[model samples]
Target: MCSSCVMLFNEKNGSILPEYTDLPTLQKGEILVKNKYTTLCGSDLHTFTGRRKEPSPIVLGHEIVGEILELAQNEPFYDLNGNILKAGDLITWTIFAATESDEFVKDKMPQKSASLFKYGHVQFTEKEKFNGGLGTHCVLKRGTGILKVPLSVDEKFAPIINCAGATAMAAHRLIDEIENKNVLILGAGVLGLIASAIAKQKKAATVTILDIDDTRLENSKSFGADNVYNSLNPIEELTAITSKFYKKGFDIVIDMSGSVEAIKTGLKFSATGAQHIWIGAVTPTENIEINPEVMIRKLLSIKGMHNYNYEDFINAVNFFEDHFTDYPFGTFIEKEFPLQETEKAFQYAIKHKPYRVLITI
Candidate 1:
C-alpha cells in the first residue's frame, strides 16, 4: 500500500503542511475508499488562512470522490436505486458520520451532535485517523451516507456533489412552487450556481444573482440567473435593483455569500412569507445588525442548514446526470493537480478563487 499523506498543521505556526503516514484500518461496517478526486472548498481555504477555526493538524479536503478498496462485512452497500456497491464503483459520501440512534441523532439535526465527528475538520487520531479526502485512503465511518457516481456523469462532477450540490438540495427542500417565485442568489460561487440551476429547472419566474465578479455574474445567466448585480457598489446598486426587480420583493432568497453583510441586505428585500435560506457563514464571526421587526413584519420563514442528508446526496447525483447538457457542471472544476501538489493546488485555489480546484489522486 502507498503511504497515506495528510495535510497537517505546521507546529511552528498555523500554516498547513502535508505529512506521509500509515493507512487507517476500517472498523466493522466501515469502508476504506481510495480517494480519486478531492475538491478544495471555500471552507477548506478559510481554515487554511485562519479565517475559520478547526481542530488543527487536520487533513482538510471534504468534497471527496473515490473508488472502494475495502468494505467491511456488510452487504447493504448500494446506489440510490439499490444497485449493490462493488469494489471499483466510484462513490461520494456525506462529510458527516451521523449514525448514532440516540436522541441527539434522532432530533433531525445529526450534524450538531455534542460528539459529532466530521471529515476535514477534526484533529488527527490514532484510531481510524485517515478521515479527510486529502489522504490516499479514507475510512468511511459506519453511519456515513454513501452514493454511487452515475456512469453518465463525468468524474469532474463528483467532488462538489457532497458539498455545494447537496447543500443546495437540502436548502431547497421546503420550496414546492419554484415556478411561481422570484429567486435571488447571493454569491455566484459553486453553491450559488447550483442553486440557480435548481431554481431555474423548477421554472422560477425570475432569477437574480449578486456577486462582485463581473465574469461570474455574467456566466450566472446561463446557469439560470436572469439578472445579476455587483455588490461592490453596495448601496446604490442594491437600492436601484431591489426597487425595480420585484415591487413586492423576492419570494426566495438563497445566501451563499460568506459575508454577513449579504444577510443583512437580504432581509430587507424578502417578500412576505418568503423562504430565506442561510447556507453560508461557516465560520464564527461578528453578528450583523438587523431589525427584528423586519422578519416579523415580513412573515418570513428562515432556515439554516449545514451538511445534507442521504436523500439529498442522491438527488444531487441524479441532478448532475440529468442536467449535464443544460448546465456544464464539470466546468466548475477549473483545474486539477496531482496529490503531491496539494499545497500548490490550494494556493492556486485561494489566489484564483476559481469555481473549484481539484486535487486528483
Candidate 2:
C-alpha cells in the first residue's frame, strides 16, 4: 500500500482537489515509481478552462518524471534482434496502459486502418496505475511500452522528454531527411524552443521562431534560433525574415503553436516542395481554411504528429544530457514547488508562466 495518494477532481468549476485514495497492488510487468516531479503543460490549462471535456476524478498532469521503486516480474518486447528486457532499468513510457490490447494499437493493413490514438490514448490505465502524474507515484506497466532514460538525466528535464521534447525531436527527425533545408517554427513556447534547438542541431541552414510574446522571443534566441520575430502579424514577420535570410520561403515549416491562425500563417510562408509538420494539438472545434491550389502549386506536404515513439524519447534524452544546460534549460524554468502544493503550482503554470512550472515530490 502507498503512504499518500492525490486524486484530481473537478467537483466544482475550476476547483481541483487531491483526495486520498487506495493504492492498488502492482502486478506482473508493472513497476511502482515514487513520483519525483511532474510539469504543467498547456493542455492542463485547457482542462482548467473546461475547453477539453474530461471525466471527473480522472488523474491529471501527463508530463511526469519519477524514481523507480518496484517492478513486476514479467518482461516482454525484444530489441532489433529480439532480446527480453530486465528490471532495475530507469525508463519512461507513454500514458497508455488500458489500451495495450491487440485491438488498440494494431494498425490494420490491406484496408489500412489506423488506431484511434497512435500512442493509444494519454488516459490512465489500471495496469499502469497512475492516471496522470498529478499523484505521488504511478505504476508503469510493461508491454504498455517504456523507454530507458539515462540515470544521470535530471528529473525536471524528464517530463519535457515525454511530451514537448519528444514531439519536437520527432518532427525534426522527419524534417532532417531533406538536405539543406531552412525551417520556420511557429510559436516560441517550450515546444517551439525545443523544436528550434533540435532543428539547428540537426544542421538546418536557418531557423526562424515566431511569437507575439517578446519575452518568449528572447527565450527562443537562447535556444539557438538564428532569428526571432515578435509580431501580431507572423506572416509579415516571416516574409520579411525569409526575404532577409533565405530570400525565399522556408524549406520546412513546423507549427507548434496549434493556433488556426498560425497554421494559416505558416502556409503562407511554406516554400515550394516544403513540408509542414503540425506538433500542436489544435482545437477540434476550430476549422482552418486552406487553399488547395496553394498546396498543389507549392507541392507542399502537411502532416500531423502526435506523441513520440521510443526513438524520439531516446533522442530527446540524449539532447538534454548533451546540451540542456548550455541552452539555458534553467533560464526556461519560471518556478518550482513541492508536490503538496500541486494546486498552486498548476495555477501558476496555467495563469502566468509560459516556459516551465515544476512540482517536486
Candidate 3:
C-alpha cells in the first residue's frame, strides 16, 4: 500500500518535511488504520514551536480518527467494548499502548506504564514509520485500547475524542462528583469547553469559565458556561466578581490553561474542601509557590492528570456519541487543511491559536 507522512526532523528548525514510505507488514497483534482526520493539538504546537522537546524524525499529530485497514491475521481483535474489530470500522484508540504486565498498569495508570508507547510522540523507524497520526496510515500497537466510533458522530468531532475530550473525562473522573457543584474551568480552549459541557451534563450548579481571550469566553457560553470572565482583568476585580457570584467559591476547580498565574488565581476562588484537577500542564514550567497553611485550613485536594487511561478514552467516546448533537462540537475546528499541507496547518494553528485545526488525511 502507498503511504505518505510528514516528519519533524528538528524541532529547533521548526519544519515539517513530507516523506513517502512503504507500508510495513502487519505484525502479531498489531492493527493498521488509514488515518482519516487528525487535529493539531496544543502539545503538537509546542513540539512544532520547540517549546516541548521530542526526538527528531517523528510524526507528530495525535488527535486522530481513522478506519481500520487491516488486522493481524490468524487472530481476532476486539475493541474496548468487546466488539470484534474489522476492516473499515471507524475507530479511535487510546493515545498510549501498554501491556497488562506493565508496572504502571497495576498502579492504575496504564498511560504511564513502563512499556508505554505513545502514538504521536515516538521517533519513527523503518519498522514502524506510520505510528503517528500525521501519516496516511497508523500502526496501532498491540496493547492500544481501541474503540469504534459511531457513524453518527461527525468525522471532525471524533478526532478530539482521544485527546482533549478524553483528558476532560479524566479530569472529571479525578474530581468524582459534579452534581449541584459550582464548577470553575480555567481556560476557554477546546479542553476547557469540553470540561464545561461535561460538568453541566453532570448537573453542576454553575459552570464558570475564565480566559484571556474574549472570543473564546463568548464561545464558552454555548458550551454550558454560566459565567465567563476575562482573566486579564485586575485581580481585585476578579476577586470581587467571584465573591459576588459564588459566595462560597467554586466547589470544583479545573485548570485547562496550564498557566501558573491561572492556577494561583483559581486557588483563590476554590471553596473549602474543593477538588482541583489540573490537566493542561504537559510541559515543564516555572513552579508556583503555595501557602501550606492556607491549603491545610481549606482542606483542599489537588490532583493532576496527564494523558489518560483506557477507561477515560471509553468514556470520552460515549460522551461525544451521546451528546454530539447537544453541543456545537463541529464548530470547534477553526480550519482544515489537506494532509499534504500539514506544515501549513501547524503554521495556521500557531498564528491563529484556534480551538483546533484539522489535517484531513
Which prediction has the highest TM-score against the true structure?
Answer: 3
Candidate 2 regions with alpha-carbon error over 4 angstroms? 74-90, 97-129, 176-179, 233-236, 245-247
lDDT of 1 by residue, 327-347 (tens): 877789899888777878878
How many angstroms is residue 147 displaced in model 2 relative to the true structure, after the best TM-score fit?
3.5
Best by lDDT: 3
- TM of each candidate vs. truth: 0.92, 0.85, 0.96
lDDT of each: 0.80, 0.68, 0.87
RMSD of each: 2.3, 3.9, 1.6
TM-score (C-alpha) between model 1 and the true structure: 0.92
Error of 3 at 47 (Å): 0.4
After the best TM-score superposition of candidate 3, give how far the Cα of residue 318 lies from its true spot, in angstroms. 0.5
Candidate 3 lDDT by residue in tens digits, 1-361: 2365555455656778777877888889999899999998899889888889888778998889999989999999999999999999999888889998888987879988989899899987777688888888999998899999887689877889999999999999998688988888999999999999999999998899999999889989999998888978876766665676545688889999998888988898888888999988888988978789989999898999998888889999999889999999999888999888888888898888888998888
Q: What TM-score would you give candidate 2 relative to the actual structure?
A: 0.85
